[model samples]
Target: MKIDVKVPAVGESVTEATIGSWNKKNGEFVKRNEVLLLLETDKASVEVVAENDGVLAIQVEAGQVVKIGATVGILDTEGKASAVSSEAPKTAPVTASQPTQAPVTSSPASAHLSPAVQRIVTENNLNPSQIAGTGKDGRLTKGDVLAASTAAVAPTPAAAPAKTEAKSKAAPAPAIFAASGKLSKQGEKKIVPMTTIRKKIAERLVEAQNTAAILTTFNEIDMTKVNEIRNKYKDKFKEKYGISLGMMGIFTKAAVEALKAFPAVNAYISGAGAGTEIEYHNYYNIGIAVSTEKGLMVPVIKDADQMSLAEIEMAIRDYALKARDGKIGVDDLTGGTFSITNGGVFGSLMSTPILNPPQSAILGMHKVEDRAVVINGKIEVRPMMYVALSYDHRIIDGKESVSFLVKIKEGVEDPERLLFGV
Candidate 1:
């Protein structure tokens, strides 16, 4: 019986995907739940798994664009098991020297070589075996082959000095052109195609700009108190919890408290029979915007307001590492009521961040710098950071927005307020 293997729905609204690569080839026997191919979508690269044990017959090749529900392969269930059992004994333990006449090289260049390695050998006339392979299963990398070619053509020590002298004497002398009459040579430019994730990010950014009423309100916070607390407890915190207590924990706790006070900033606007109303959520799921090579992905920390400072720090660290490694899922990137982006990590002094759509607000945290500021009528140098809260003006008014940021500023400045629920 032939079983149709169709592309499963990856996520909501994702219609199609590009075939990144296939792990198993046609006619190969595969087991149930085995990874058959990798499919790259606008958001992520997902592995297509085999549904049952069978002989695979791929309908699509790598780099082909396929839609959701498209039949990309078929599995012949009845023939596979029998074929594997029959062929295993015949092909097993076949020795390289078993009277198999030098595996017929079509050309002096045409040994058993990969397409890329073969091309390099044919173009440069280099032997494959001489190249040191760094790839898995003793395959040669492009770098290894190129390096071997250079080593093979290098002049011997006895011939080096004479060759260098001859080349220097034969080479053309430097040409000095008149400045007024000189013709400048144009350099070649290369165009590389953008990845699917990058294209989607571009589209989403434009859509965000068009859809939301973005308004940025900036405020500077005296990090003196926060820094003092961190410096005093950082060693103990790391030793006890196995994670460093960073500013994110302090800021996240503060943000959550501020959200509680200014519920409108944390709420989402939706239309009901009575018209558009503010839907305030008691639970806080804060999205931490992390930048990755693939694109910008935001992973939410569910019920962040209820988590301890140590837990929040650990969660942020885990999510950040996963995001960079591309191990984070589509579900992790969705469903957030608010977002916090740390531009300070990249050494940003100040920036007006744009709001992530469907949500009301996004907080941008900038780098800390030491400057002079008034402290109880006395001027002192202290660590300070500028925080910008960008919100949808349609949902959050200026008073509510400013007050919301002020609450954060106050909480951060006096972190003990977070402990006391002030």
Candidate 2:
């Protein structure tokens, strides 16, 4: 029996994905539920697993674009895994008419090189054993091969003699050099192909800027009350919930209340032509922007208005971990009425955030700093954080945007209101 391995639907809107890389080579035996390849969609990297224990026959190559439900490979259930040969190699196996070659040893790194890396290694006439792999499972990546090729051609006093020896060792092949010149610093210049996720991100950003009538409103919040509340119950809260009570929960709670008061900020323009209208969502689904190694991701917290502070903290923590590990899915990122991105985590003091398309508004949180302020007719120092709200001007008017921000300030400045449902 043969099992057809097809691409799984990643999301409602995502119909295609690019093959990021294959974990197992063709003809390799894979166990049931083992990861066979990584599929890179616009929002996330999904792992495709084997359905049953069988020998793999890959039909798609790395970096190839494949549609949803397309068969990427096949699993032969009845086929037996190739057995390893135990007989020793002949001392003199080459005939008079055949060329001699050096013996290659099988190592973990060498055995799992991706198709792209294997091509680079073979084309450069380089030894896979010499290159150190930094990828998952100690697999040789294209970067490793490129780095080895660069090191091999470094100019030295014995370059001429070493060149002759290298040629004699392997079949003659053209030396691979950096595009611009001879040996330069390794990291100085090397071209890398853009990934599907990155390309999609760029396109979406540009589209948001081009399509929306974007405008920004800024306000500052005194963090004194919020900090005091957290300091008072952080330990107790963590002990109760097994998660840290972070500022995200407070901000999310505040935003949800504000969105209720100013529904325009939480609405978006829909339809087409003159018949287009503003779509107002009765429910709250807030997207939290998380920065990951691959890129920025926004994972939605469904029905955020109904979740308690402890639940909000747990959800934010889970999404952050998933985004960082590339385990977040497209569904995790879709269907949000609003978005909040904290640049403060990266030490940013102030920045105007761009709106995520279809969502009318996005909130930007900045660093907290102590500043002198007039309170009760006297100068006092307070920890202040500047917040910016960027919204689509067509859907959200200036008064509504400003009022929405003020509502957030009120809730944050008086944390008791959130607890009491004021």
Please report the candidate that would top TM-score against the real structure: 2
- The residue pairs that clash in candidate 2, if any, are none
Task: List lDDT for all candidates, in order.
Answer: 0.77, 0.84
List candidate 2 segments past 4 Å from native: 83-160, 163-188, 273-275
Judged by whole-model lDDT over C-alpha atoms, candidate 2 comes out at: 0.84
Estimate the TM-score of every prediction.
Answer: 0.71, 0.79
Candidate 2 residue-wise lDDT, 1-422, digit = tens: 99999999988888999887666667778899998888889888888999999988878876789999999999999887653211112223547543333445677788765434654664455668767788778877668898888876666564568667876887444445454535445545457677778888899889789889899999999999889988999999999999977899999999999998899988889988532798999999999999865678899999998899899999999999787656788889989999999999998999999999889999999999999999999999999999999999888889999999999999999988888767
- Between which residue pairs do clashes occur in model 1? none
lDDT of 1 by residue, 1-422 (tens): 88998887989978998776555656778999997776667776666788888888778766678999999889888764333212212234547422221222233222334433543453454546555577656666557776776676666687778878976786543254334435336432446466566788788778678877889999999998888999999999999999988998888999999899988888887775422777889889999989875668788999998899999999999998776544576677777899999999899999988777668899999999999998899999999999999998888899999999999999999998999999
What local lDDT score does residue 100 receive in model 2, on the 0 to 100 scale? 36
Candidate 1 local accuracy as lDDT? 0.77
